[model samples]
Target: MKKYLLLMTVVLAALSFTSCMEELGSYEYMDANEIKIDSIKGQSITQYDTLRIVPTITQSRNTSEENLEYLWYWYKSGAGENAKIDTLGFDRNLNYYVAAVPGLYSARLKITDKETGLFARKEFDISVEAENSGLLILSDLNGNANLSLLNFANIFSQDIYYAANGEYAGTNPVGIADIDNAGTDLHMIAILCADGRGGVVTEPTSFVKISDYSDLFYVMPQPIAPEAYCAVAVLYNTGMGITYDFIINNGKLHYRDFQYAAYEPLFNPEVSGDYSLAPYAILNNNTLLFYDNKNYCFNILKCSYGQLKETKLDPVPLPEGTDTETLAFDPRNVGLEMVYAAKGWKKMDNDAGYAYGIFRKPGSTDLTNMYCLRFNIGYNMSMGRDYFTPYFKHSISGATDLDKATAFAMSRQDPYLYYAYKNKIYSYDLEFDKGKVIYDTDTVVGPGARVDYLYFRPDNESFNMWAATSVEGSTEKTGSIHVLGLGRNGDIVKVDTVYRNVCGKVVGMTYKNR
Candidate 1:
């Protein structure tokens, strides 16, 4: 019985082998098209520059080039799953003009064989830089507001705001603020004007208007008065950093936390306060120190839990073992009104220390009696009411014409507070309690040129003073911007660069980072 079974199995195996051979011989085989992409070079170009890429491709089979479909596109590098893919072209080569903002990108070429349904792809890095980036001077030109750019290459481009927007930013432009981390979409430039037009937020790279000032609020105020705009970075307890953009309109604080949504109407109710704020304020890590002009005192806005809560600063306290007579002024209830206030040189671990403000008694017309008040809001808000401390209160010394000064700026590199008075620039050394003339615009720029604005680039570590000046009697392109190099002792070393007669009467300036 076993021998008979072996025979049957051999017979079945032989039949199955013959069947497989016959099936194999009946089938036909052909080579499929395989795509090969050659190495493509990386690209580096400025915004608005043409980005051209010609790729070399080959196929393994004898397929016609017409049978292939091509796609060229780019997206922000490292965007991962949320990357926004922008189509560059749908051709074999790329010749796309880059209108994208300044950033790192990844350009890709994808070739697909339409017949074989096979694909090949190649990717290369691309760096897009701003074509016009540097100091942006917002000036009042011929009764209108204009924006000018002094580029990194030392070339000046005037009326950039008008060129891009086809209209003036607004008449009587008072200030410009760069929202470096406005949102994930892009940086923003807030152009503020006092001409009842409020302000406009524009794209940082192109100066293209994004929205009108009224559009930035959930419920617009009755009379729009945009005074200042600033974005401050605050670190939370969860180890996350959030940037909140603060807008001061008619002495009210309006803020938006970009982490929640992009450009949503700033949180409503404006900080729940009845006090009118001064036009100037200082921002520490998670706290905003604002002086209430109505109450003649200071208010603290502590940023936490994605909401701004008012923190009551304890009364100014004398340090342990210090003389009670050494106290200068009460920070919580300062009796004077602020004229100009700026962040000082002293910095704590997580906060700005010793902010200086020039103040005078309310309803007093005597500017010469103005006093310099220095104080610090403690670095740690967890300390509760103990955060407010007064440092110095004294009359400004060794400087003349305090009443005639138009602008004031403080140097973070040193204890020098600079003020622009007519045609001269004076520096008051806060540490030494002395003041002296730093630069004379009349002698340097021209005979009738007067300093109209004084600012130090907030990001620059060195003391490169920026002064905006104009002729006393003219408003038509009479503005000039100078970058003055400063010595360690707070003296002007030389005039490094100057843009003469570039825009209108300069009122405000801010640096635009690339």
Candidate 2:
């Protein structure tokens, strides 16, 4: 059996996983006697089986003279009041349950503030489907409100993705990401949805926009039609091939209409068909850089904003069977030069510590004249980290090895690459080819700062980039953003703490110029 491992978020700092905290919402103002009824909130029930309806209630009496009270109203559409839930718990929680044939139902909330005289009443309705599908919720992140489904006792795992609009385009979404393009308010995102029958979760819409989304979108549509999307690779009727539907303005979703044709890759014998992994980056409105699946080759697709030109090919000769995924491109490299962490010891067929290597895209094809940054494969995982003792000079001698990094962000005045280790942030000056490690000072970051997400702000000076660190591990994702120091040249410069917002599992990070 093949063990499953997530490539994006690499080896994690292990920690205890806690049940997600009660993520709830509350009202702003309330009074004991004011004529106000808090909107009925926190109503959860199962499908046709066992139903647990727990609605929060609060009531108060002014001056601390009177006590709080609680009441629950449970009734059918036409029934008066035969079954009423008036029970309270030690923590003043109301737990009421009902079991009925799948249909419409109503529940009420009664709140009485204990210290002061205040009371309110509210009611809401819920319809339990024939069979409970899954619990769904919406989160507005980067203009995209994704539908996150939980508690489904079914398959091994599922991946889900959202259209630029609110529609869930791809299948079950296991992971989603967006990397900014040129001037458009857009980026590429993929949904790792599960394939109905098993092993591989077909990566559909290897890229999708987040701005164009909708609430009318359903994960499972009736009559069964493969949702029109961009596919990394599809097993069509004839055979398996690459497929992508250029999105026109989806009517159901009010989005911008793209003046382009939907794409259907007609197999060409002239070219060695390779479109397995779609990793393309649009540098601007004109230049497009992409890597085919297997990471064996890279292509630069040049085109006008309206028409895509012929793909320029280049062979990235790896150490025999060594495969690569996460690659970073540097815009300031003399030519189209970039770096990617390769696998080391796995290349037992090769030399010592020849695990991962950083190959530069010096010129187009022919990997003859290439430079290897690090001949070790240890940095292959998406979140893997290795620290160098304070004595390594050849590797850190003026920040030379810093070029073999995964994170790269560029701006008008400042452009830099980052190698996020366990306790410190290393910065390599792109112009000088030398790097420096930044330490947390009394005023800057903590002694051992762990960065999760990082980006460069185009408008800030002195501090060009910002770092967001997880407070603990992926679960207790306590993290904050700090400023970058540009004062010292060769020494480790400390950063300053500026913003803080603890995240949950700090999944992925993308910096939009906006």
Each candidate structure's TM-score, on Cα atoms with residue i matched to residue i, is 0.71, 0.35
Q: Model 2, 115: alpha-carbon shift in Å?
A: 67
Using lDDT as the measure, the top candidate is 1
Report RMSD (Å) for each prediction in the order shown: 10.0, 27.5
* Total backbone clashes of candidate 2, pairs 3 or more residues apart or in separate chains: 50
Q: List, residue by residue over 1-514, the lDDT tens digit for candidate 1.
A: 9999999999999999999999999988987888988969886777787888778889998546999999998888767899899999998988888889676788889999988888999988887767876788899887787999887556799999899989998888889977665245445788988989787889887889998878877788757888887666531212233366677788887777665664444545476667777888777555567888878887766656445544232223334565545567766667888888878886656665668888888887565677888777565442343466777888765666675688888888788888888888888887666788888887777788888898887754567888899987785788888899888787999899887888878888887755
lDDT of 2 at 96: 41
Worst 10 residues of 2 by lDDT: 247-256
Off by over 4 Å in 2: 1-272, 275-282, 292-297, 302-305, 309-415, 441-449, 457-463, 471-474, 485-497, 511-514
Winning model by TM-score: 1
Q: How does residue 105 of candidate 2 score in lDDT?
A: 52
Clash count, one per candidate: 0, 50
